[model samples]
Target: MNNTHRQIAVIGGGLSGICSAYFLAAKGYEVAVIERRAHAAEEATFGNSGLLAPGAAMPLTLPGAFATFAGRFQEEPRVLLASGADFKRNRWMRQTRQAQQQRFAANKLRLTRLSAYGQELTRQLQEHYAMEHENSSGVFHLFRTPLEAARMASLQEGAQQCEVKHKTLDTAEIRLLEPAFSSEAALAGALYYPDDIAGNCVLFAKQMRNAAQELGVSFHFSSTVKSIQPEFGGRVALELESPHLDSRLTTDGVVLAAGMQTAELLRPLDTPLPMRALQSYSALVPVKNPDDAPNMALFDDSYKVAMTRLGNRIRITGLLGFMPPSQAIPPKALRNLLKIAGDYYPNAANYNQAHFWSSTIPILPNGMPLFGPTRHGNVFVNVGHGVTGWAAAVGSARVLADMVAGEKSAVDTEGFLPQDLAA
Candidate 1:
């Protein structure tokens, strides 16, 4: 490994930071990853839906987004509702409303470019790091109602404009793909994205961390970043506070990938970012009969449930809405999730021994994440990816790495500037 003196500090050891550090290390930059947790990806990144579905790339601020959200509001759990007093919700709503008009169309174009770029980056990592995480199984979207099925079919028109590969399947066709789904409420038809795949997010992060370490990148797990100060000559210093230590490190460059806890650190620097948290639930269940389980990952759009088969365990994760970070995962939300899962795939798994979990998704109101360098010299951000963090992390990391290394990017990042706002 080349011994480079240009040390770079990365805050947050989740998928975003790990991928950023790994890519920079690959380019011969000395990298240090400071994480608040005892292990990497212990937060939202640990148990994500794990879809590499770039085809699902659509801005959250679409023209009909409000209608879609309103229609499904009653069916969603109470904990998902945003509290009026929450500072994050207030900020997020302002930004979301601002993004509704012509601004949303521009955001969609940016997301399409970024997400497609992200998918390419993931493919590169699978080859570059030689890591295995149950990837390659395609993704399926099952529709319980004809109306829901029609909505998916309409989405295909937009998908075609982006050149995303997908297929529509009828009831018998879906059954042939997964025999376990025999319920009367079983989806009438489905939309399949062959390019989409699943994997263990935590395992992927661990493997990438290992690869980075092999190339001399340092990881300081459990080291919480206290503050960041802009220093002289285009550099920044990071203050770290943790149970066992208090220290500081100076770097030529810094990337803020901190999920929900990013606003405060940016506030001190006068680079306030619009971000919020949307909590979601997931359950891990062991398969009753291995053959009955679906080989391809499934996303039931109507019920908002997505299922992924991870070796011996089936990970069913979905149901999104706004919530405070400190609140515990609601019991009703968990029960509702299990009910939906059973309705979709009755024979796929036995929920008796399932383990329930919940985590927050860092969100920007428009559903587009802010990436690239901030106005402050040498400070960059790659957070607020919402539900697509794991899917988009590697690609965003690659773009940042290229920026840091003074190389040209394959994707155009014109709309991804750190502080760009819509009118």
Candidate 2:
């Protein structure tokens, strides 16, 4: 991989694209990140529920997850919302159901592997840059129901096998760990992962982008990519709608990291992919009493919610968020989120003044991010990350850059190859 004058164009300046730019620049390649937004991390990466939990990287589509999803939708309509008839014909949903029934274990194993690798890569960036994402170590996955407690506790075995350090904490142990949680709460038990950490994902992306720019990476803001076409010897170029730029821009290579929009760009190249945007709701509440807040992160398996203390603010997120990207999240959706947050940490934050947000994370049916080169050779995709985008973006981008530079990847990217997902 001679990097004398090699250049690459990365679409989407979110976490994935910035990471690709950072890694490519580190490898001494001229990289340009063409972003549709005015700033980086202003999209899905902006308000992500920040958890680097490789110990629980399993997809939502477990063996019986479909039943749970269906029941949640029935019990609480706001938990999963569908706005159009197009949802019925969603190939990603259909394939997710099929894969859950057949390849559940395989999917979990692959995600776990990539997530673990990503966690390590993230630590390097933190050490090098002295990151300030409000990183707090250890996460408690609390269970309220007896069945769910037992079911989630079973993951302890797999975590051990994968060498992810963890602990099964009892009522007293959890109390000592984080005394902010109410003892009257109906938590049956908890699985504590000491290695897991929560941080501000948006800050991380912004810092990474700044670092890349410091190393000679260029960024194009408020730019829209119209099309991508293959050129001579399998190279690719992009057509843009910009004021101060040429309508068409040529690049030695391209990595599509624009969330669900990646599928649109690939469609023009006859490589249409199944990528769905699972909208997620997040709230940022200012903490009134920092001492009373849960210093550690908390994940409620039954409710599908997570709460963490980010500096003086508390962030809580829940729901599967299955709706059109353009659809505004109904104001009523906050009821469930408020209920769950109050049930766990009532006095930790001021929810009345909470800032509500919605983000659409790109997801594939199998719950694995698409990585590596495409059939066009010079085109690589780094989308379909879903909720794990924050956790795995850097590692995936590092490997993607390596592949673009014609070098062996630091992580095994076999199961997530483009042809591997072709059905």
lDDT for every model?
0.72, 0.77
* Model 2 Cα lDDT, one tens digit per residue, 183-259: 76788778898888888888888899889999899999999999999887656779999765788998788889998
Q: What global local distance difference test value does model 2 have? A: 0.77
Q: Write one digit per residue (lDDT tens) for candidate 1, span 65-137.
A: 2443466534444235643656555555666767744465566556655776777777777787787868756
- Please name the candidate that would achieve the greatest TM-score relative to the true structure: 2
Candidate 2 Cα misplacement greater than 4 A, ranges: 1-5, 60-78, 83-91, 144-154, 187-189, 326-328
Model 2, TM vs. native:
0.91
Instruction: State the weakest 10-residue window (summed lDDT) of model 2.
Output: 60-69
